[model samples]
Target: MSQRYHVVDRPDSRAPLDPRKLAQVLAQDGQLLLPMLDLIEHAEAAVDDLIDVMGRATIEAVLLMSAAGVAGPKQQGKRADRDVVYHGSQAGRVALKERQLRVTKPRLRKRAPQSGEPGEVEVPAYEAMRKDGRLADRMLEILIAGVSTRRYEHVLPEMAETVGVSKSEVSREAIEAGERLLKGLAERDLSGPDILAVWIDGIQLGPYHVICAVGVDADSHKHVLGLREGATENSAVATALLEDLVRRGLDPERRRLFIIDGAKALRAAIDRVFGADQPVQRCRNHKLRNVTGHLPKDQHEQAKATLRAAFKLDAKEGMAKLEQYASWLEHQWPDAAGSLREGLEEMFTINRLGLPSLLRRCLGTTNLIDNGHSAARDRMRRVRNWQSGSMALRWTAAAFDAASKGFRRIIGYEHIWMLKAALEEPAKDRSLVQQAVAG
Candidate 1:
């Protein structure tokens, strides 16, 4: 008997090779030189051919192993009589990235029918194909790319027509994808990243609220750290989000800056989770809006300009100037005065630390988190009704993950080293103060 062999094309086959195409392939740098049209035609054929070859090989290997008594009898193992015999192959199908291919799997049965039980022999090849998730992944990718479920038949009539009507299959696959993403976000180790600052904020979707934390690393790159579902931005919800990050290896003791809107719950959460002395920079923009809302419409611009001018002064001078303005306003508008005095020291945190204008511009506001919320909202704008908190969390996680792709270093990022130095100053001073108190 002669052994059959299948031949493949040679890399430089001179069999009617187009010289222009060959020249282009040679001149190009590292890249796939296969023609697009040819790949589409041959890829499916290759997959089918491979599956059929593997199917036959699997059966042949099983027969050989059975005859050799590999699974029949062994020392200290259950012994089987020579009653089991080979049976005809059964038709099956395996999913591949290109398409589904038909396969024939051989079976074995007892020579004497004691019972209707069939002998089970493992097919490693078929199992490998079954475990290959590229087909499902590609399907989900297409769906995310705006290919509607109804159009799957028209999009890939040869490969995905069955999938068009299998809405449940698509849903199951999407759920798996979403769970994987959520798990990755939640369980990722954060100790490896040199996170220099955290921007925290809450976003509302229908009746659910999600508090999200975005971290800025030492290199000025941004990361969506984690999120928690909450009914409102309360201390408990904020604390849980921060604690989860800590459990995932975020060092709460580290003197990283915390930039947040004027939420007392977030401030308290930071103090409780990180430390009472942790450096917190209240978003100056939010403060400005709150302060100006108390003044008359005609006085708003002047008040904003006054605060802006005060921010340009040094920390001591800025605080004194703001305090003077508060005193002046106390005569007529006490509410506005109280607003300026509340968290007044935090308003000039960037100034107190003496960071560069560019770096301060990035650290002085919760704009980064706000921008992430805006991007996330844009991604989920089509969602009309968020049925449950879990649903909102899933969709928000997906949206934020999508938004994270567009994150670049904050503006004036080159001077980030200055911000890092400033963040360290407070911790150093506190240690010194503690030592003095001990003395």
Candidate 2:
């Protein structure tokens, strides 16, 4: 073999490694060095490897900083000046975003001022990390996004020795988070927002039924106001929901256009809670469905078109056309005719107020709250069981919370001011009438 030349054998002119010099260099050019270091580390690494490396490095840096805060600067020799002493380090788990991380937590002790006895001191960062509120929130989001508790781990980033991702753990976190969200929604103060209209409807989840109230503010923003668990959407449940809203500062005396799916119980509840004078608009869609359900398949299109045409006319003309249709259906489809005649004038509430077609289309029915209910259903579709009323309520609240994130201003929002003006017109007329009588 030929003689080998080693570079290490040559005398090197570079100075010995100096901690002080290294610190100065890092302090002066740390920002510039990061890109170079990244290039060297990731130059040959795969994308996934690069991500893992960066994530672990970031986590390690955070843990190191936390350790330093607790233990202070390391001493080369014994120093009695420091009050806090490093006792040791132990394996600890912390929740970082949605993931639980295993870290070597530095333990510390402090000498009691009075007793001179060393007492264990908890690290603030560790204490904060130990609280997995964010993890619970993430669990709620993932569950609502249609991931089952059993398969939750598959959706998360792979890690070594990951903890707190079991099905039971996920369920526990989800329940806790769901309860918090439910409580938040139930206790939210409605007095602050300038709510212009209210839509009330019911949704059936398994054997349980819940009456939900959604409010629209003057700015056309929607708020999931309240819900009450019931066996059916009866007057009692609807009344309780409405009374709860009033108690939560919905202003019972304030005139608001009430939209409902032609549920007499809901209408009665509104009358009882906010007075019958509150303008009520029955959902045309619900009416059409009820009517068509009574008629034959062949007559469905004609009845629907006629009813829709009736809705576009002036209040007097619309009511006349609807009455004529009801008469035409009286002999064969009395139920369909009755459905058309029921709450007929309420269907024209927007038309009577002379609102623009935009506002008419938006406020004419319970479509706004119906859309929200659809969103809630979509989020909860993955859930197969409903154990209790409380559980149903919790899941509903969580689903609504997730769905509310994507809510946009109602279509024809620019003319929402007109609806507000129309809602107040009756009150204004009543006030004028009272003044005139007094005068």
Highest lDDT scorer: 2
The residue-level lDDT of candidate 1 at 155 comes to: 60
What TM-score would you give candidate 2 relative to the actual structure? 0.80
Q: Can you write out model 2's per-residue Cα lDDT over 319-408, one digit (the tens) per residue?
A: 898999899999998998988888887888878666898888988888887787787788788788888888888887887787778888
Local distance difference test, each candidate: 0.70, 0.76
Candidate 1 TM-score to native: 0.67
Per-residue lDDT of candidate 1, residues 251-367 (tens digit): 977888889887888898888899987778889888899999899998899899999898888777888899999999999889999999999988876776667877888888989
TM-score each candidate: 0.67, 0.80
Pick by TM-score: which candidate is best? 2
Clashes of 2: 0
User: What would the C-alpha RMSD of candidate 1 be, to one decimal place?
Assistant: 11.8
